[model samples]
Target: MDTAAADGTAAGNTTGGRPGRGRGRITSIEVLCAVLLLALLGQSWLRSTLDVPALRTGATVFVAVCVQALPFLVLGVLISGAIAAFVPARVLRKVLPRKENAAVGVAGIAGVALPGCECASVPVARRLIGQGVAPAAALTFLLAAPAVNPVVMVATAVAFPGEPGMVAARFAGSLATAMTMGWLWARWGKLDWIAERALRRLPEVEPGSRWRAFTETARADLVEAGGFLVLGALISAALGVLVPAEVFGVLGEQIVLGVLVMAVLAVVLALCSEADAFVAASLTAVPLLPKLVFLVVGPAVDVKLFALQAGTFGRSFALRFAPVTFAVAVVCAVLAGLVFLGGAR
Candidate 1:
C-alpha cells in the first residue's frame, strides 16, 4: 500500500507541475491574438475617437512620415550592416589620411559613399572609433554620413525641384558642419569624454560568417532605429496638431525668429534625413534659409540623434557634443545658404 501510494504521488506531481507551468506563462502569439481581439471589439470606439479633424490630421501626418522615411531607414541599415560585416576597420584606417585634420576631410567626403541616415551612422562611427580610427575622423563621418549622402541629396533635390541651389547649399552646409565638428574635436575634444565601451575594439567577424553577421547587424539596427523614428513621427504629429498655423506665419515674417524656430523644430521633429527635406519644403511660410537650417540641423543634431549619441558614447559626451553640433550646423547652413541660395532667396 505504501509503494502504491508513493508511485501515485510521483505521477501526480509530474503531471501537475508540467500543466501548471504551461498554463502560467503566455506566449507572444497568444498576447498578439488577445490584442487583436480587444482592438476588434474597440474598433468603433477607436474610430469615433480619431474622427476629429485634429486627430485625423495628426494620424495622416504620422502615417505619411513613417511611410516616407522607412524605406530610407531600411536602406541605411543595410548599408551600415554591410560596412560592419564586410569592411574591416583596417581598411578604413588605411584609406584615411594619417593626420587627424586631413582624415577629418577624407571622412567627410567618404560619407558620400554611405547613403544612410544619422541612425545608421552612429554605430558605424562608434565602430570606427573602436577599431583604431582617429576619433575626429570617425566623428566627422558621423555628421557627414546622414547629411551629404546621395540618398539625402536626391531627396532634397526632389523636394525642391526648381531650386538646384538648395541641393548644393545643403550638400555644402552639411559637409562644412561635419568637417568643422571634426576639427573642433581634434583641437579640444577629450578621449575620456567618450564611454570606455565605445572605444573598446570589437572582435573581427569571421569571413565564413559574414552573411550571418550582416543580417544580424542589420536586424538589430533596424529594430533600434525604427523605434526612434516612430517616436519622432508621433511627436511631429502631436506638434502639428498643437501648434497653430498662425505661429509659423508670424515667425516666417521675422528672419531671425524663423531661423531660430526652425532650428528648434528640427531638433524637436527629429525627422529622418532623407524625408526632412520634404517636410521642410512643405512649410510654405518658412523662408529658404530657415528651411536650409532645418535640413542641416536635423541631420547633425536632433533629439533622436542626441539620445542615440548618449546611448552609444555616454551621456557626458552627448551633453557636450549636441549643442555644439547644433550651433555649428546652423552657422554652416546660414553661410552656405547666403552663398548658394543668394541670401535665402
Candidate 2:
C-alpha cells in the first residue's frame, strides 16, 4: 500500500462519480479554476483590441510559452505518477549515494536516470529528503537533477547547435550551479529553518488497482502541483508581454544586473528547467550570459519552488536558504560566463 493509501487518503472515489454511472458532479474548485482561466483568456483578448502593442505582445508570448510548456508539465505529472505507482520509497532511498560528497556527486549524475522536468522533480525531492537523505545532498539533487537531466541537456545541445562550446557551457554551468550551491549550503547555508512538511512521511501507495493508484496519485500531484505550475506560467507569460523589448539589450552589458534580473525571473516565473531553454531563447535582448543564468537558476529555486520548499522544509529555512542559493548561483553563473563563455583563464 502507498503511504497515502495506508493512511486511507487514497481509498475512496476521488472523483466521487463512477466512470460510467451517467455523469458526476463538478467540484467547486474545478469550476472556479475553469471560470478564472476563461476570464483570463477573455481579458487577454480584450486587451488586444486596445491596440496597446506591448500588452498584446506580452500576452501572446505568455500564452505561447505557456502552451509550449504544457506538454512538459503534463509529461512531468505523468512521470511523477508513474514513480508513485511503480517505485517504492524504500527502494528509491537505496538508489541514492550513501556518502556525503558522493551524494552531491550522484545528484549531478542521477539527473540522467531519473529523467523529468522541475515540476516532477519537486515531489521526488521531497520524497528523497523524507527518506532520510542528507539535506545538502538532497538540495544538490534537487538543483542538479532537473538542470542536467537528459531532456534538458539534449535541448541545450540543440539550442546551440553546431556550437558544442555552448553545450559544454550549459553542462558545466549547470553542474557548477548545483555543486557550488551544495557546497555552500553544506558550508554555511541554513538547514534548521527548513519546514517540517517537506519531510513528511512517504505515502505508501497501495496497489489496490494499478489504474486507480495512478489516477489517485496523478490527481493529488496535479492538485498540489498544477496550481503552482500555473502561477509560474502566468508570471512568465506576463513578463513576455510587460518587459520592454529593449530592456534586455541595455541590461545585458550590465553583467550584474543581467544575472540578477534573470535570477529574479527564475524566482518569479518558476519555469520548469526542461522548458526554460526555450524561454531563454525567447529573450532576444538579454545576452546569452543572462539567459544562461535563467537555465541555471530556474531548476534550483523560484517563487513556486519557494512555496513548495517552505511547505516541505520550513519558511524560515526557505527564506534564508533561497536567498543564499540565489546569491551563490548568480555568482557561480557569472564565473561560468567568465571561464567558459569568456576568454578569461
Candidate 3:
C-alpha cells in the first residue's frame, strides 16, 4: 500500500505488508532447487540402501550422461562468447530470409557458423530473432546450430571409428530434421506467438571500435550462455542416473522405438549440436536408426532448451511447441532412418 511496503514486496519479503513479488520470486527458485536436491539425495540413498539393481541403474544412467557432456558444455559457451564478440549480429541477420522458407534455410546455414550446445543456441537464436530475423529462419537456426557445426562432425567421425557412413547419417539426418521442423512450424504452428521471430536492425558500432565491441560482447555472452549450458548438463546427468540403459535397447531396434529413443535423448543428453554426434556414435548398443534419431532430436529439443523457450517466448509456447517438435522430429527421423539407416549394417 505504501512506498516502503511496495519496496519490501518487490524485495520478496513476505513479512512486510505488500512485499515485492519479484524478490519473493527469486527466493522461491532457490528454495525449489534446495528441495529438489534433498529429494534426489533421499531417493539416491534409499535406492542404494535397498540394494535394488534397477534403482542404482537409473542413477548411473543419469550421472553418466551429465558427466559425459560437461566438457562440451564449457566448450559451447566459450565458442558462443567469440560469436557474440567478433561476429556482427547484422552479419548474421543479413544472411537470413526475407521470406519464410528462405528464413529457415538461412537459419540452417547460419547454424554452421555458430557452434554451441542446444542451450547456447537459445540465446544466440533469440538475439537473431529479436534483431530482425524471421520466425522461420530463427527456428531453423535453433534446430541446426547444435547439429551441423564442424566440431560435431569431427566428433561423429571419431566416435564411429571405421564407419564413415555413420558420420554421413548424422549430418544428413540432422539437416533433414532441421529443415523439416522449420517448414512445419512455419506452416502449422502459431507463428504469431513467437516474440523473437521478428528481428529488427541490430545496433551498429563503428568499424574502428569493433575490437572493443568483440571483447565486451564475448564477456557478457560467456556469462549468460555458459551458465545455462552447465545447468543443462546437470539436468541431463540427473536423467541419465534415473533411467536404465537396457530398457532403451529393445526399443531402439524398432522404428517406433528408434524415434522414442531420439526423443528421450533429446531430453536426456541436453548436449550441444556440435558435440552430440560423437555421443550418438558411441552408442553401438542401439540400432543405427535410433542413433540417428538421437542426433537429430538432441539439437531440436531438450529440458534446458524448453526452459529457454519458456523464458523467451512464453510458457504456453514452450509447452505446446516442444511436444509438437518432438513428434515431428521423431517422424522425420523415422523417414530418414527408413530411407538410409533403416536396415542394419
Best by lDDT: 1
Q: On lDDT, who's better, 1 or 2?
A: 1
Q: What is the C-alpha RMSD of each candidate to the true structure, in Å?
A: 3.9, 8.4, 7.4
Error of 1 at 125 (Å): 2.2
lDDT of 1: 0.87
Instruction: Residues 35-76, candidate 3: write the lDDT tens digits.
Output: 999978799786568776655654554445445545554566
Per-residue lDDT value at 219 in model 1:
93
**What TM-score, over all chains together, does every model reach?**
0.83, 0.73, 0.66
Give lDDT tens digits, candidate 2, residues 147-228: 7776677666654556555556667777788787777666776546666777667776667776777677667756654565
Q: What value does the lDDT take at residue 168 in candidate 1? A: 98
- For each of the candidates, give the backbone clash count: 0, 18, 24
Question: Over the full model, what C-alpha lDDT does candidate 2 score relative to the true structure?
Answer: 0.69
TM-score of candidate 1 relative to the true fold: 0.83
Candidate 3 versus the native: TM-score?
0.66
Off by over 4 Å in 2: 1-60, 155-167, 185-203, 209-213, 216-243, 343-345
